[model samples]
Target chain A: MTRRSGTAVLVAWLTLVWVGLWGSVTAANVLGGLAVALVLVRVLRPSPAGAPAVVSPPALLRFVLRFLVDLVVSSLQVARLAVGRRVELRSGIVSVQVPGASDTLLTVLADAITLTPGTLTVEVDASTATLYVHALDVGEGPEGVQRLRASLREQARAVVRAMGTAEARSHPTPLGRTGDRRREGQP
Target chain B: MRDVLSAVLMLTGVALALVAALGLVRFPDVFSRMHAATKPSTLGLLLITVGAAVRMREGGDAVALLLVAAFQFVTGPVAAHMIGRAAYRSGAGAQAGLVVDELADVSAPPA
Candidate 1:
């Protein structure tokens, strides 16, 4: 994006946030917001912006709906296991690559995934764009790793659709899937 | 009916918080405890704010409540990631009941 547009977008976002925080959209609020936003943007001179995400409202809504469902389901699962008498779990950290994720997309994906129970990020390998996820429970065996890895990639795809660059949105396949048993047509 | 719905949501949220506390005490390790701390607690906060918002039925205040939820959603995961990463690199998970660890073979990401 051009310098002018980037500055405009940043100022607009900051102003919107300022208004939203104040819980009013009066003329005073808008003017104050604009003043603060302009000052912050011009004075602070935030880090240069990266590849702009092509946001799709419908896809964002869908991703949020799915994440909420995941939140509830995973929370309940953890709650049940927590309440059980003798806790037995097969926790493990698996390194999985997210296909087509840039720094921004990867951060969003990690945040969304970590917000849900059952899985959290142990570490991040930004060079390879990999996430080391520590799962609370991974069921029985290696298939568990497969399942979790696939789930992570699936969420990345959803994130890409919601707010990612066009190239990332197109390249949704995890490159390591070439030999995996997961079929192309499987649900 | 609105009151009833709000009560139910609030109660459920509190119950989830209780579950989180219970998990924190019962879970075996730091990572597991963090799992307990992160998810249910955030969900609990969400449900409570949503219930309160529903109860209020005001347009402006609901926006503020939504903002609280948004900030929590954004920051909670980041805090958990930092702690989890630290715990892992410190070898805190060497005996944390791992069935497999792929990261063991590969070096952790550059600090």
Candidate 2:
């Protein structure tokens, strides 16, 4: 969406919230909401870096459905682990490489990862766009790290597909997935 | 039937929150404890909000309840990320279970 439209949406959402809070949407309430929302939007504008959040409805549906499934499955896993006895935990921190990902995509990806039980995003290196995620269980050693990282990178790709601009979508995200394809010369 | 369903959902949400606390106590380190605390708790909150909305049955109340849930969903991860980053930086959660520390090479320390 363009900057102007995004601001309009923000204002509209804020106005809705105000009306909802007021319960009965009177003229006074709506006017008050509009004034407050306009002021808030003007005061706290988001950075230009995430200017284009041109979301695809289908891709977003795909991401949201997959995310909900992950949330349910992972929450259950954690719940079971809590109730059940466990011997040794093979938890580890794996750094996922998602270079040039926009801030909005990163935020969405990190939020999804954290909401999922198996993985939590510890740190996001914005310069390189790397996400350092801590997994609840990733088997063991280097291979485990690689596997989790790859999966999380897949999530990042999904976010891109859902929310990325046309240029951002054309990034090397799908062209040559890391380590999977080795027939041609690997980067 | 609606009330019964609402009760079930609310009870399940409460149970999940308990599970979150259990994991927080039992988990080995900071990161793991956070994993336990965050995921289930967020889901539990969602469940509780939905249950309440269903039972309330008023448009205004339902909207408010859902808005609370939405706010929680947006803010929860941000809080966890800050804590996680801080713990990792301070070397707080680097215990024996950590098999891979790939971040050590990249983020040295914020100067």
Candidate 3:
């Protein structure tokens, strides 16, 4: 993968944020923003270790479109559930394994899931690369959990596809634990 | 036309904020409460900021409003995630009506 221009991108984004906060785009503001962004980037840059993931613009666009749709649909779902006469929610924590993803991508995926209405990411087991997600509906039995797991797998796959490199996508990892199948039958 | 649009946006934003408040009171558990707190509030804030920018129509004001909205979008999820993690660790998920506790193994030692 090509080396990421992290510094340039960070500086530009910070400058935009700076201008937005100041509510002005004058030369003085822009210059001050550049100075601040430069300092911030120096302070906040991640250690140079693993190569950064190259984001595919097309995949990123698709991810954004799908996320918007999910956002609206889930918001309405939660709103209805909240205001419904009988609020019957079968919530469960489901562990999803997102293999080969960088720390940044995993955090992004977790944030995206939490931002969605019905699901909140409760924990990220960095050791195992597992995300513990609390879903609003896990159905009646194992089947429900399985279904949710499948959907979460799809979400994780979408994220990896959108942002991961060609190598990371090829060696795809199993999304959930096989042992979960047994526990699914219990509750 | 601008005034009408701004009025509509502001009213909708206020309504969303009201719904978010209702959810905060109505939802049973911390996780669900978080669902209420983040999504609708973020959307409401965005709508209100957009409305304010439209009403002001000044370059600086508009830019500032947009920046506020952007910051909210970025920080809202991060804050929600941290709160959710804290709740999960504290056994808040054990509240009645919670169906499954997959993180039981992870949280057991903490409590």
**Would you estimate the TM-scores of all the predictions?**
0.86, 0.91, 0.89
Off by over 4 Å in 2: A174-176, A179-187, B108-111
TM-score of chain B of each: 0.86, 0.91, 0.90
Q: For every model in order, what is the number of clashing pairs?
A: 0, 0, 0
What candidate 3 gets wrong by more than 4 Å, as runs, is A1-4, A48-50, A173-187, B109-111
Q: Per-residue alpha-carbon lDDT of model 1 for A1-187, expressed as tens digits?
A: 3457667888998888889888888999999999999999879998644566777899999999999998998789778978988667888887667655667778888888887658998787776667888898887887877888778777777888888776676763533473232233311
Residue-level error in angstroms, candidate 2, position A132: 0.6
Candidate 1: residue A7 lDDT (0-100): 79
Q: What proportion of true contacts does candidate 1 retain?
A: 0.75
Q: Give Cα-based local distance difference scores for all models.
A: 0.79, 0.81, 0.76
Which candidate comes out best when scored by DockQ? Answer: 2
As for candidate 3, its clashing pairs are none
lDDT of 2 by residue, A1-187 (tens): 7778778888999999899888767899999999999998778875556547778889999999999898888889999988898757887777675555678778888999998759999998777566788888888666776677678877877888888765567776542355222223323
Pairs in steric clash, model 2? none
Candidate 3's error at A64, in angstroms?
A: 1.0
Off by over 4 Å in 1: A1-10, A172-175, A178-187, B57-59, B108-111
Q: Best-fitting candidate, measured by lDDT?
A: 2
